[model samples]
Target: MTTLDLDFVRSHFSAFNEPSLAGWSFFENAGGSYACNQVIDRLTNYYRKTKLQPFHPFPASEQAGREMDAAINNLAAYLNVDEDEIDLGPSTSQNTYVLAQAFLSIMQAGDEVIVTNQDHEANSGAWRRLTDRGIIVREWRVDPETGYLDIAKLDKLLNDKTRLVTFPHCSNIMAHVNPVAEISAKAHAVGAKVVVDGVSYAGHGFPDVDALGADVYLFSLYKTYGPHQGLMVVRKDTREALGSQGHFFNEGLVHKRLVPAGPDHAQVAASSGVTEYFDAVHAHHFGPQADASKRGPDIHDLFQAHEQVLMAPLLEYIRSRNDVRLLGPENPEERAPTISMITNRDGRSVAEDLSKHGIMAAGGHFYSHRLFQGLNLDPEAGALRVSFVHYTSPADIQKLLKAMDAVL
Candidate 1:
């Protein structure tokens, strides 16, 4: 296993701390991560110095606009795509809602869309809404026992009428990493465009949108150690086909067209901090082997490797406890670091017990209500979620394990 440099990780983020009675363990990285100091500083500085609207003719506004553009460009370059392919929105949920409306204009009433029960409501609900317009919606079911999305099941759902297929790259509740490329190919074979909800997976590491072969991919910046913003990457061809969702004046801008909401300039400027964190990690881990010229996918892979190593022990410890029933795949190879587990006792009760001990784990459906129901776990009786990121420490895992042992 590749080793993560604990000292370097601690140096980068001040949020890494031991469990305290007055504080929380912060195991909810899947929902949102604590913002990095670098991001906070950048945002503060921007607000203090300029406080002007971006893209104006004045020097201050122009410089601010340039900074915002640089941030978007950096993120796009990291994702291995052209700048035009990326659109910045206020939130992932908002982006999905807007994109769904855009699809309505392009797709005919008879067109079919495949949606999975394993996705958060953000991905499933928006597309499913198309049903009201006479669009056919196919359900990509999950295996109740194992919480796995069978590719065979997805195969049966596809046909010539399938115009779009939406699912999570990694489920927020189940944590299973979907076979994106394979699914993308299957959908494309049937003339359907693939849209992936990457909110849970993107924070663990950067994903190459083009390599995933997804026509459109969406994720949240807040969950990835950056600002509160949503990112959507659309293939150039798909963007052209979907048409714009914006006002008549902005119709010419393909990126703005899908996002009817005006861009949040400060939040967009703050997004560059995610790359800043990535750059710092890459330099620390790879040393000279890390090339500044390398794109987002390369740097992200390094962080993924490091995170995988750190998460292995925690997963193993959780598996060892007979009282705990782990959700999703049994092995780390088949899952992300977002581990959701149920105890013999009530999930919330266990979470409360842990809370008394300063463990900041959460217990709920996590908005993947259909997934919990499919797994035969009552959505009302939510499972305890203990998710982590690249910045998570070994000591933090140990603290969680100790809390779990006591609570369970």
Candidate 2:
């Protein structure tokens, strides 16, 4: 098995080399990650030289269109989905809002839609609003003590009337990686379509959308070391089931149907850089002979192995503290690198104190207010979140532990 080359991985991201951010360690990666040099360079070149309307006869326009198309096709290959299924929107929140609207037009008044307490507002709020149109919205609540969504409970939620089921691949606050395939299977048994929010999970590694068995899968590129854009994959059958949200004339185009806000040409084109970065990492560690589809799991395993090692000490420390309540699983294999804790101290104040030691972290509800309320946590003060990615070093984790000791 090939391990991820940390030296080779760190070299792709420009943030590691910045003078101002030199000594300071970043742990707020769940909010957003530093962009890789490949993405930045592509974005700069697109704005400087190819700042023209795409798909035109001119040189700049043709090149711009090619880059954008390549991004969709390349990413689709990595995720093992069709190119037509990929939709790039402004943000994940915006994407779900549009999807909900499409569902609204097609769904009947008695139709049931299920939402979870564990999802970010991006996936929850939109579907919940369908209640206004006489749709029956059911809540798939989480365990207050552990913040885990019990799969057994979902069996009761799904019925003949259930039209859709939306949940997260992993919660931002809880950090427990949900079993998408298992949940999707249960939903499918009841003839319900599944929508998975992968925004929290994608940074670990892009999951195979086909394998996950979700009708609609979403993730944010900004959190995945690219530009601020949301990438959505809607299965062809599901897309055809929903009403088109785009213009009447453009209704025939499946890709443009849901994203009526229109595409950002430069950012979409720059997304190709994300694929390029993954390829570079794969080629450096393993051989360059593997196809894009084959490389996805290899790169995914490499990052997952490295992240689990980093998560163990942090989990052990948090779980041992009498004053703190650690959210999600203690085992690193069962979760991502996002660790949140409820402490006797104020979340904001603890974050401020950590900053003095040059550690970057955050404290807030993270837009999962329903989750906090369900767990009997105060939404006003929220919980302290320390998140990181494969780029984070062991030295950084040591610094975080030391800073946390001083604050607590």
For model 1, the stretches where C-alpha displacement exceeds 4 angstroms are 17-23, 288-295
Q: Which pairs of residues clash in candidate 2, taking residues 3 or more apart in a chain or in different chains? A: none
- Model 2 C-alpha lDDT versus the unseen true structure: 0.92
Q: How many backbone clashes does candidate 2 have?
A: 0
CA error at residue 107 for candidate 2, angstroms = 0.9
lDDT, candidate 1, 12-89, per-residue tens: 665654344235667878889878777887788789876788888999899888878888887887787888999999
Off by over 4 Å in 2: none
Q: Tens digit of lDDT per residue, candidate 2, span 1-408?
A: 676678889999888899989889999999999999999999999999998889999898999999999999989999999999999999999999999999887689999999999889989999999999999999999998889999989998889999999999999999899999999999999999999999999999989899999999999999999999999999999999889999999999877899998899999999989989999988888877467888988878988899998998998888778998888899999999999888887677789989999999989899999999999989878999999999898889999999999989
lDDT of 1 at 68: 86
Cα error, residue 171 of model 1, in Å, equals: 0.5
Report lDDT per candidate. 0.84, 0.92
